[model samples]
Target: MALFLLAFFRRYLLLVLSFLCQVYVLLIRGTPIVVQVMFIYFALPLLANIRIDGLTAAIFTLMINSGAYISEIVRGALQSVPKGLKEAGEAMGLPFYKILRHIIGPVAFRRMIPAMGNQCIISLKDSSLFIVIGVAELTRQGQEIIANNFRSVEIWGAVAVIYLILTGLIALTLKLIEHRMRIV
Candidate 1:
């Protein structure tokens, strides 16, 4: 939704909104996601005096962090849509939102598939990072088992394999969807 608004009104709202959007993207992409998570989970409560649980913090952190990058991908895709299509839509007396919903969105989303797939893979793997904040994710669970059983190599190996399987499944699923959605 943020990306949609930004891309749709970017020209009309270019001056203030564009700068704000750029700033948001810069801040999100500049810092490591781990740091972002840490800040939200720890520093936010300290500064705001509002207590949020680790899970909530982690979800918010990941959502905002991923949202920034995804917005950029979507923004680029929206821009890459051909001007002729927009012109044609206008010629047919279609409204802007109709053109966007029926034409630009579908085409640009198709273009965004590969990049979106990668981001999904990254997010899945990154969930492990929440272990640092004691969020009890897959990596954290693996670590606990290793600590109890003293099977570091086996546990870590299994964890790695699980992650690999997850990413593979994500890639496979995306490929299937891409094939189905392909223009050919």
Candidate 2:
């Protein structure tokens, strides 16, 4: 949704809408994800009069938080595509969608892979923050097991390994994709 909004903003930027997007990005990026989770889990129910479970709140907060950063990544990637290529497409009488699909999209997607991968890893780590709102995330589950068994070193060490494995897999996958998609 944020990507779609960014595409629209890029193509036909309206002043008011542009300002709103900037404000949205600024607000989300300015605050901590934990605070966002707490707001969604605790305050939203009172303010909006809607019941929300911890998992639901966590998911919503992460989506909102990550969307803001991802949109910026996309915006930068799209802008980084050479203007000359776009102009060349225009000279060939390609429509905007055609130019975007056939020319700009591929280049921008290739350039954005590393940044997007980084964002994914960050978002994965950020999920631990949801534990603060009583969501039974990996960290929370680890904490529970430690509380019962009092094996802090072993349990915490296992949790660290799990996180490292997950993040490593994400990086490896992105690197493979980026290598395969490299311009030849």
Candidate 3:
């Protein structure tokens, strides 16, 4: 599965990209998400000859955005894995990769859950910014409906409620994952 490879690749990528992650977070966190969205949607097309649809552009932008934050969460989790555990695993003659796979990763991942959950919620909300690029996500779809009907108050209110429900569902799903992982 793609997810399996993604997880494996992400684990090693976090180690390799730790410093880059720090820079990305520092640079982007100083700027507004709107600015980032605008640059991706507007500036890139001007500089390059390529043209992408709004939805594709949105996905690309959000992946870059989320990756920076997620990498830091991963790096911190990797660092938080006790040095003693690695040493003990070494003492048991486990290979470095085996130690990482069998010992350090599982514990670090459990501790990383809450931070990753927060990142997931952020990514979900950040998807809303795609509307500025004319991506017909929930917000953009709602905006089109409101624009046609001229029911600003009710339509936008419903949009906000829908966002709230979507966020709540994300939180609940993360909680369930945390619970199940904890039980194991």
Best prediction by lDDT = 2
Which regions of candidate 2 fall more than 4 Å away from where they truly are? 7-12
Clash statistics: count for each candidate: 0, 0, 0
Q: What C-alpha lDDT do the candidate models reach, one value each?
A: 0.87, 0.90, 0.78
Tell me the tens digit of each residue's lDDT in model 3 across 1-184.
Answer: 3322333455556665545545666776667777887887888888896787777788887876776677667767877887999999999999989998899888878888889889888898888878787888888888789889999899889988988998898889888888887944
TM-score of 2: 0.96
Residues 36-85 of candidate 1: C-alpha lDDT, one tens digit per residue: 99999899999999998989988998888888878888888888899999
**Total clashing pairs in model 1:** 0
Worst 10 residues of 1 by lDDT: 3-12
Q: Which stretches of candidate 3 lie over 4 Å from their true place?
A: 1-21
lDDT of 1 at 25: 83
Query: Whose TM-score is greatest here?
Result: 2
RMSD of 3: 3.5
lDDT of 2 by residue, 75-182 (tens): 888888999989999999999889988999899899989999999999999999888888998999999999999999999999999999999999999999999999
lDDT of 1 at 144: 95
Worst 10 residues of 2 by lDDT: 3-12
The predictions' CA RMSDs to the true structure, in order, are 1.5, 1.3, 3.5
lDDT of 3 at 65: 74
